[model samples]
Target: MRAGVRNLLNIRTRRVSLAPPGLPRAFDGFSILLLSDMHLGSIPELGPAVVRVIEGLRADVCVFAGDFRLYAHQSGPTFETDLRRIVDAVRAPAGLYGVLGNHDTIDDARLADCLGIRMLVNEAVSIRRDGATIRLAGVDDPHTYRLDDLDRALAGAPKGAFTVLAAHTSEIAADAAHKGVGLYLCGHTHGGQICLPGGVPLLVSTRSPRAYACGEWDLRGMKGYTSAGVGASIVPARFNCPGEVVTIEMRAKSSRTRPARTSCP
Candidate 1:
């Protein structure tokens, strides 16, 4: 257990691809930095480690999957200070987007807004590049709060424009797929937080399928990737599942594809 606690700083950068069919040519090579479940105050020192990794990386867009603070309804100077530090270190030219997790509150959303993270609570935003636009829709925390409205979040998306839904948990995956979503990005289980060998998880907290609880998964052709996350929850420790900062490259492909591959650095 002590070793697992010390492994909290072993934050690896996992690289994968998101090549959902019908992706616009403009976004063929778009890169996204996915950060999630950063229960910040759980381990104070984890902040600088994350910042260091962010400083050395760049992405077209950065998405925070939520759980900014360690506990729900708990915020203080330390949490705010650490949150600001981590957000300020991001290097996404397109923008920083986020959704709230079970551990976050409305005030936490407001705090993220103050830090320039566009919190998409039951809303959507469009990202344009070279005359092509892709929609990013995010919902509220669906694990504990269950306040997400998929229709409201995806209301204005055009007929066939590729849409990516960012929820804190993958519980809404089936609904999103039914609604024509092309890609889904989320992180809530922390990859079990304490896994056995080969990174096999002992428990994935969400009620979603165990398949969608960790890495890349396909639900009826819609692609999704659940981050292992950058910080711990429940306790500041990790086992075989080292926390991760995921970088995903979006490609234009058909044929019900899987990610191009995963590389570690």
Candidate 2:
């Protein structure tokens, strides 16, 4: 199949719901749309398709896991145009937030501002609803940039508040669990982008456990999802692994059924 046809045919949405321990009542049923590894400049034609998919989804908050642009030093005119189109099309009541990926440049912050999306670089922000709050923390790229700092990201979070972290790669899973992070959202491996039959990844480009190559998993004590992502990289084609946009519904764990705390690696 043609690259565009393959991408169009494979782009799909994955919905997941979780009720992790200690979730606040206010955040119960909170829904989030997770988008990652856009790699916009790589395949410019896919931009509108991605925007269309996002526009059709409904969620309280939208989180972009990263790779807004393809090359580290590519010109911004095209990237800015395509990114603005995609960002403008999204609607989220809670807000739109994102972090940078290895292929993105520092100047992409200006693009983020243009799109009205908050770019978090090793920082945390609190979103309130009905007088209750949840903390959203984000770190820099952990792959090519190697600039992630989990401590710095979670330093400003309120004590005992439910915290969700966004990073470019699942490599931070262990560290995030150690810090008591409740949910971790990331995408970089693309589930190998192109995989063998039965969805066996021929290669997963991260230090995270093999199981975390894609989909949801319990990393130590933290709940996490590594998205297959919406765009391709290295090559603009995907085989068995389709591109994805993830929807995560967060429900509060039942108080009576809360499990005892266990040590995390």
Candidate 3:
């Protein structure tokens, strides 16, 4: 009973809307369901809850920001089974994409492929809808096992195409902005994994500014969000910081006007 209560209290869905400059009219109102830092092996029971939440949400695409496992070396068949089940439950017409996180092994790619997730390791792909195109890029983990290659990730993106990048850590927000990436999505901090009252994080583990630790932030001309994550790490308990799945709605800004820049409260 206590476990069930904790699951109910700790997990939630957060909805966010963004209108980045230069978003294509064809892709306006596009919605993406973003999930990160699942840490499946660490909190096994969280899987069913995550699956339920994702299956209930509506999205044009679904993107995972990695850390699918807790202990890299210890992740085994159990982890794969839980991950596959969660992945299968997600529904998106545009498709599903993911990147590797610090806690995941290279072999996790096979599991992702089997589950119909395209693992993007420092790569980019373009998706089209209703005669409009947007580029989606992903880089490897930028935290512990750093292997991120921002240049290569954006290499295939066409000039002036609206681009979104999926990275494990918000530390790359600045670089992504400089490269003209319109939006950057990430999750790894877990909002300190524990916190003070009113969801104030005590210690954010990223190299980025504390302002970018969790929630949305504007980095120069780009927009970025660091999710609190869907599972806990280090310990199976969260204080004021609850686990979450984020839904980002994309709207197109008028061609003659610039989009307003905003930061997380």
Candidate 4:
């Protein structure tokens, strides 16, 4: 138990590179810092620990996949205070964006906006560089809330441009890929908060396939990554699964990459 407790302070950085077809060359090597599931109210020390990890890391953009607090109804002032501290520590040059999770409320979305993190609520945003563009479409929580509208989020997006979908869980992967999403970013499973040896999760509380529970996965031709998360949920201790702050590098893949298949989960 002592080792498990100490594991909370052992947050690590996981770096991954993604090369998706149709990605804009101008956006090649585009770095995105992905953060999720920081249930600050569950563990008091998590807030500062997360801040310390992300203080100097640089990225082209930053995004938060939700669960600002432990419970969905928790709206204390300190939750806001700690969230602000974490948000202020981010170092993304393009901007910071976020999406709400099952354990979040509309109020949390509003608070994220106040803190300079653009909350994407069933909408999309574009990051253009050197005349090339990539779209970031995000939807509401689909796990428990069931408010996600993938079609609405991708309404105005161009068909040929690369699109990255920000969802709270991999449960929405099927729909996002059907709508031509190039990459999907999410975090809710916490990589199975308590895993067996070899990082095998004992329980991955998600409706999607187990493969999408923790790390990079491919749905058809779409590239996806589900963060193990930065803070623990339910319990503050982790076994084989340590908390993580992920940095993803997106590059342009060769045009000859296979076309997206019709299968999905």
Over 16-134, each residue of candidate 3 has an lDDT whose tens digit, in order, gives 87877778898877888999988887655667778887878878899999999877887534687788888788888889999998888888867896788999999988999998899
Over 102-132, each residue of candidate 1 has an lDDT whose tens digit, in order, gives 9998999999999999999999999999999
**Candidate 4 ranges with C-alpha deviation above 4 Å:** 75-77, 255-265
Return the TM-score for candidate 3, rounded to 2 decimals.
Answer: 0.92
Pick by TM-score: 3 or 4, better one: 4
What would the per-residue lDDT of candidate 4 be over residues 1-265, giving only the tens digit for each residue? 7787688778888778887767888887888999999887766667788889999698999999988778886644467778899888998979999999999989888889999999999999999999998898889999998999998989988768789899999998987888789999999988877888778788878899887887888888999989888777777788888888888888778523323331111
Worst 10 residues of 1 by lDDT: 256-265
10 residues in a row with least lDDT, candidate 3: 256-265
Q: Best candidate per TM-score, number?
A: 1
lDDT of each: 0.88, 0.81, 0.83, 0.84
lDDT of 1: 0.88
How close to the true structure is residue 92 of candidate 1, measured as C-alpha lDDT? 95
Best by lDDT: 1
Q: Estimate the TM-score of every prediction.
A: 0.95, 0.91, 0.92, 0.93
149: Cα error in model 3, Å: 0.4
**Candidate 4 lDDT:** 0.84
